[model samples]
Target: MMVRTVLLAGCVSFFWTGPVQAGMPSVSLDLTDIAQLRLQSISFFLMVLLLSALILKLCWNLLAKDFPKLPRISYKGALGVSVLWGLMFLFVLTMISGARELLTPGAWEKSGRTYRLVEDKQPDDASLAAETTLDERRRKLGELRSALFMHVATHQGKFPGKADETTFAKEFWLQPGPLQARYGYVAGDKQADPSEPLAFEQAIYGDDQQLILFTDGAIKVLPTTKAQDVLNGK
Candidate 1:
């Protein structure tokens, strides 16, 4: 009964340590302090040993029921097996963590004393606003593409001419906004090549990227220079 109680206590301690460590304040390790580092290493090793012992105890209990003639594991024998398992587990975990840090350096950022994952980093307001604006522009362009197609279907396969902005606006319920003002339309019919650029945004974005709508009703974002070449019929 005492041995069972000890095993239960070890299991509880092993599982509880993770959350407790996670909740503790982040401490910057002093590379010069060998004694402190050694203490931390020893604590980690002992925790792993206890966890391995608990796992072995559970496995022995399960197997003993099936193998009735099997001799029970002595404390010393269990300790030896636990140490081997613990060492292997620690080595594998260290390798994986080291590989991740080396291969994807940008995935982690040091903030104050702690390393934070890129996913956990919050976007600043300016970045958030820019992303929102870009999304809105894309959505507006999509709606405009649908409206142009509707116009083509009704007007004998021709899109609205550049001279008929008022007619196009009223027919498509398009409001005067950044999207409508910044984007230029090409006068073309449905018979034009499907990959031909039908409309494109001016190079107004800070990133020098433009959104283009094709005759086939596809929208794509391209670098401003390439988009300009396409617009100029090159």
Candidate 2:
């Protein structure tokens, strides 16, 4: 009987319990572990209690005097106790699991934001020093627009009048933003043969230039926002 109880506890624990380490390594264990442990402990205790009661009943039936009646062991009582134990286990498990998620370090952990900043260090302090890089980029984009307009005016409103790299380079120096250029250009409609993978509208980001100038002449000061957005777009 003891062996059966032990085996039951072991099997149930094994099936119900998850590995000690399950979540993201950096985030470690949270509420789930607590729930698993609680359920296992309750199961173990219930098995032991029932096993003891069964053994006592067997002994009493065999050895007790006829005149001195053995105490009543109602199946109803055992069933009620088992049900109560199960419900209590479930209640505690549910409450704790829910509570742990609210209390534990998850999305609320500000460290995630800190890690993001550390991960995306700018190419230089120059990127950080600018008061408003986006604003500056917006202004530059206007200049590029004017240049594109002029190129079109000179060549009957058509891009790549001759489709020469030097001519296109001179007319519109595709200043792919740091974020956009790093990945490479998206070809514009004007260029019959773009740098490579001719795109209808191109954006260039060259590491050597130390600038992330967009084809639209917008600057990307923070590589994270602009760079990530552009890269993720692809």
**Global lDDT scores for all candidate models:** 0.72, 0.48
Please write out the lDDT profile of model 1 over residues 68-151, one tens digit for every residue.
997678556778888886679989988987898999988987786567787765766445434546677788788778777877
lDDT of 2: 0.48
Return the TM-score for each candidate structure: 0.39, 0.24
Candidate 2 vs. true structure, TM-score: 0.24
- Per-residue lDDT tens digits for candidate 2, residues 1-234, read 999999999999889866675566565446587798888889998787788566655555556556356665455565566667678998998797667667753533236323221244346533533333445444554455556545656766554323252243442443324333212334445532222221122223222222243433344443444544554454
Record all residue pairs in model 1 with backbone atoms less than 3 Å apart, i.e. clashing. none
Q: What ranges in model 2 sit over 4 Å off? A: 1-72, 104-234
